[model samples]
Target: MKKSIVLISLIGLMIACSGEKKESTEETQITEEEVQNIEQSAQEIDAVIDSSIQEIDTLQNEIDDLLKDI
Candidate 1:
């Protein structure tokens, strides 16, 4: 009958849609974890840059003192 065919088609459609929803949720979770890891790495790099700048400033000051003595 036409009614049975339509019912079966609806069931199939629902099952297919449900599968897509799960896949989307899993992908979102993976993206969020990656974003968090990237943020942590960025923070670590910023700290290293700050430390390097401080070291350069100290060396420059020492050089200026030597020049003053000369």
Candidate 2:
């Protein structure tokens, strides 16, 4: 679910950054810095996801150990 959500959000962001952007009353464009920032943000998100999965696995192992004792 988290991956799906992140994928969707990243896809949307990529689409938004892919083409010329113009506001209704003004001209606005996606900059190189914005794209770079998005890339960094995605990396950070992946790191958080990795850590979260690891924590969940650790907790699950602890739970399984307890179940085995009982």
Candidate 3:
């Protein structure tokens, strides 16, 4: 009786483990709209970064000019 109980418990555990593996192995599918949206977000981020770099360069040049005058 104990042996049967242990065997059944082990089988139940195995079934639970297999179910989890199937869920974990499933592939995620992204739609084309999602891809386009990601690309647009990336482009927006790049534009922001470019403008920030230009601003920093302008600030650095002004600082250098002020130092030269002093």
Candidate 4:
């Protein structure tokens, strides 16, 4: 019957859709080496930013001292 065929097709479609959902929910594992590499890169970036800020502060102080003399 047409009704039975339609019902079976819908059930098949639902199963296919549910399999895709499970695949999407599965998490990708990160290795310990990958985590360590990420941490090291972050620390390097922080060090560079801190050094640049210190340099800017030093230059600003020199400019202020010159302006005071003027």
Best by lDDT: 2
Give Cα-based local distance difference scores for all models. 0.90, 0.97, 0.95, 0.95
Q: If candidate 2 were superposed on the true structure by all CA atoms, what would the RMSD be? A: 19.1
Candidate 1, residues 11-70, lDDT tens digits: the string is: 999988886343444443467879999999999999999999999999999999999999
Q: Please write out the lDDT profile of model 2 over residues 1-70, one tens digit for every residue.
A: 9999999999999998999876598668899999999999999999999999999999999999999999
Predicted structure with the largest TM-score when compared to the true one: 3
The TM-scores of all predictions, comma-separated, are 0.55, 0.62, 0.64, 0.61
- Give the residue spans of candidate 2 off by over 4 A: 1-25
Better of 3 and 4 by TM-score: 3
Q: What CA RMSD would you report for each candidate?
A: 11.9, 19.1, 5.6, 6.5
TM-score of 2: 0.62
Off by over 4 Å in 3: 1-25
Could you tell me which 10 consecutive residues in candidate 3 have the lowest summed lDDT? Answer: 18-27
For model 4, the superposed segments whose C-alpha errors exceed 4 Å read: 1-25
Superposed Cα RMSD, model 4:
6.5
lDDT winner, 1 or 3: 3
Model 4: ten consecutive residues of lowest lDDT: 17-26
lDDT of 3 by residue, 10-67 (tens): 9999888886444566789999999999999999999999999999999999999999
